[model samples]
Every structure is written in C-alpha cells, then in structure tokens.
Target: MNDDMRRLVRVQEIMVVIDALQEKIASNPAEVARLEKDLLAAQKDADADRARVSELSKDRRRLEMDLMGIESKISKYQSQLLEVKTNKEYQAMLHEIETCKTERAALDEKILLEMEESEKRSAALRSMEEMLERKRRETSQGKTRLDAEAQDLMRQVGALESERTEIMAGIAPAYLQPFIKVARQRKGLALVAVRDERCGGCHVRVMPKLIQQVRRATGLIACDSCKRFLYVPDEPSRAAGAGAESPAQ
Candidate 1:
C-alpha cells in the first residue's frame, strides 16, 4: 500500500473503533431503560399479588362477621324456646333457629373458601416478592456494569479520536477528501481490497486495466461500479508462477 493508502487505512481503523465505542455508549442508556422497565413490571406484578391477597382477606373478614351475626340470632331463638306458650309459637321459634343455623353453615362454607383463596394468594404474593427482589438486584448489577462499560468506551473513543487526527494529518489533501466523503457515505468504509479480480466493495468484476492500475498503486482507482477507492496488498501475484511447473499435490 502507498503512504496515502496506508494513512487512509489507519484512519479507517480508528474510525471503526470510534464508531463502535459511540454505538456502545449510545446503546447503554437504552439497555438501562429496558432493565428499569423490567424491574418496574416485576414490582407491578408483586403489587397485584399483594392486592389480591388483601381483597381475599377482606372477604374472609366479612364472611366471619356474617357467621357471627347468624350465630347470635340462633342463640336468641334457642333462649326463646324455653318461654314458648303454644305449640305454634314453639314450632315457629324452632324453625327460626333452624333457618339461622342453615345460614350460619353457608357462611362458614364461604369463609372456608375465602380462606383457601387467601392462602393461595398469600403464597403467590410471597413468590412474587422474592422474584421482585431478585429482579431488583439483577437490574442494579446490570446498570452498574453498563455504566462502567460506557465509561471505558468513552475513554477508548477519546484515544481513537486522537489517533485518527494524527493519521488524518498524514494523508494528502487530494486523497483525504475522497476518503472522508466515501467514508461518510459508506459507513466508515472508504477503501476496499481487490480480490479474485473483483471489487470488494460491490463484488463487481473489475476491468483488467483498472485492476492492473490498482495493483500497481499508481493512483487512487475507484471501482467502476461502486466508485469506492481500491487497494491491493503486497502479496505475491496470483499469476506470477502460473507457467512454471505445478507444485506436487
């Protein structure tokens, strides 16, 4: 590679590094945001579980109160049975006791069902709480690591920027503009190597004359198709020994 090509390649190397660091820095915030969202979602789930258990507990309390009221009514009816003056009165009092007892049994059954649901809800809430704690710890750790990584990437970007400035100064003004323009347009790729007699940038077959020019590094030769500058390495020519005896296979 010529001095200009070498310098441009160096600049490209630095730009690639800088671009990667910038991307990582840019993406770190998004990752942190995602982690925060995940943590929030877990907290919401835990809160819902706790709310469910709280509602079930309230229902259980209401059922117990109803059961107590029914019991009190049944006891009063039983006490009135001793003072009943007629068979009809006694029968009516006994029927009232039986009705209260039935209601009490139904309330007891409902209370039991509510208790079961409360127990399940409580267990689920506990599990969710544990999960929430774990998620919180994980999110915290992830943010810490991401922050550290972002800091390191910024440092690397600073160093690469300095190196890029030096390499840019080494390139000639005539060659620098095209490199910068193409690099800007092509996502930091201004030069490409010719391989198999094809343009590496667009993979189009290069004309023989242009290929020879690129190999000689006579001047910056742009690809016919992609218009990107071409390069050739210092490796031996593929056809240098084609007419000689073939090596033993």
Candidate 2:
C-alpha cells in the first residue's frame, strides 16, 4: 500500500476502536440500571418479610394481654361464688367462671399459634435480610466495576481520536472527505481490497479495468458497485512488478 492507503487504513483502524469504545460507554447506564433494579427487588422483599414478622408480634402481644385480663375476671368470679347467698346465684357465678376459663384457654391456643407463625416469619425475614445484603454488595461491586470499565473505554476513545486526527492530517482533504463520507455510510469501512476480481467491501465482482487501476495505484480506484476506494495488496503488486520484464505468454 502507498502512503495514502496506509493512512486511510490507520484511520479506519482507529475508528473501529473508537466505535467499539463508544458503544460500551453508551451501554454502561443500562447495565447499571439493571443492577439497581435487582437490588431494589431484594430490598422490597426483605422489608415485606420484616413487616409480616412485626404484625405477628403485635398479635401475640395482644393475645397475651387478653389472657391476663381473662384470668383476672375468672379470679373475681370465683371469689364472688364464696359469698353467694343462694345456690342459684352460686351456680350463676360458677357458670361465669367457666366461661372466663374457656376464653383464657382459647387465648392460650391462639397465643401458641401466633408464636409459631411469628417464628416462621422471623426466620424468613432473616433469610430475606441476608439475601438483600448480598444483593446490595453485588450491586455496589458491579456498579464500581462497570464505571471503571466505562471510564477506561472513554480514555481509549480519547486516545483513538488523537491518533485518528494525526493520521487524517497526512491525507489530502479531497481523499479524506470521500473516505469519511463513505465510512459514515458504511460503518467505518471506507477502503476495501480487490481480491479475485471482487470488491471486498461489497463482495461484488469488479471489471477487469477497475482491477488493473487498483493494481497500478496511480489514482483513486473506487469499486463501481460499492463505491469504496479499492486497493491491491502490496505483495501482488510487487510480484507483478518483478515479472514485468518477462515476455507476455
């Protein structure tokens, strides 16, 4: 390749790197968002579990208070039975005492059930909290790693931009403009090699005359199909040069 071709190739190489780096930088935010969303879900689940445990605790406490009140009432009724003036009143007080005892027993059973449920909920809450903490740590680490990677990619892009500028400075404006225009349209490939009578950029066959012009490298030789500037490799050109003195078969 001649000097211009070399410069163009260098520019394309730098652009490819720059494009990749820019794409990574653009995608960094989405990655961070996904991590944050995962962490948020974990936190919400932990909070819900904790709330359930709290509610069960309140129920257990209320049941305990109710049992204490029922016991006090039963004691009062039994003491009143001792002072009853007739068997009927004594029987009525006895019935009231039995009802209070039954209510206390029910409260005891309810308290036991509440305690069992609270235990289960507490265990679940602990598990959720641990999971949430792990998720938080993972999210934080992921964010840090992603941010560092994005910063590094940005730095690489900056360096590539500097290199591209220097390479572009060596080429004439007329040649550089067309390459830039085509590269923008073709995704960073402005020049292509002509191989096997085909345009490398579009993979379309080229005319014999176009291939000969590319071989000479005497002027800009664009592929008729893809409009990409075509060049023949230096090895083949040199080989052709070496055999130029041989008589044509």
In model 2, the worst 10-residue window by lDDT is 240-249
What residue runs in model 1 are displaced by over 4 Å at the alpha carbon? 215-218, 236-249
Q: Write the per-residue lDDT of candidate 1 for residues 121-153, one digit (tens) a residue.
A: 788888888889999999999999999999999
TM-score of each: 0.85, 0.90
**Residue 126 in model 1: shift from native, Å?**
0.5
lDDT for residue 249 in candidate 2, whole number 0-100: 15
| lDDT at position 111, candidate 2 | 94
Q: What is the per-residue lDDT of model 2 for residues 1-249, given as tens digits with 9 covering 90 to 100?
A: 556665777688788888888988999999999999999888888888888888989888898989999988988888888899999998899899889988988999999999988998888888888888889999999999999999889888888899889778878777788888988888888898878888888999999987876766655678888888997755744445432332221
RMSD of candidate 2 to true structure, Å = 4.6
Sequence-dependent TM-score of model 2: 0.90
lDDT of each: 0.83, 0.82
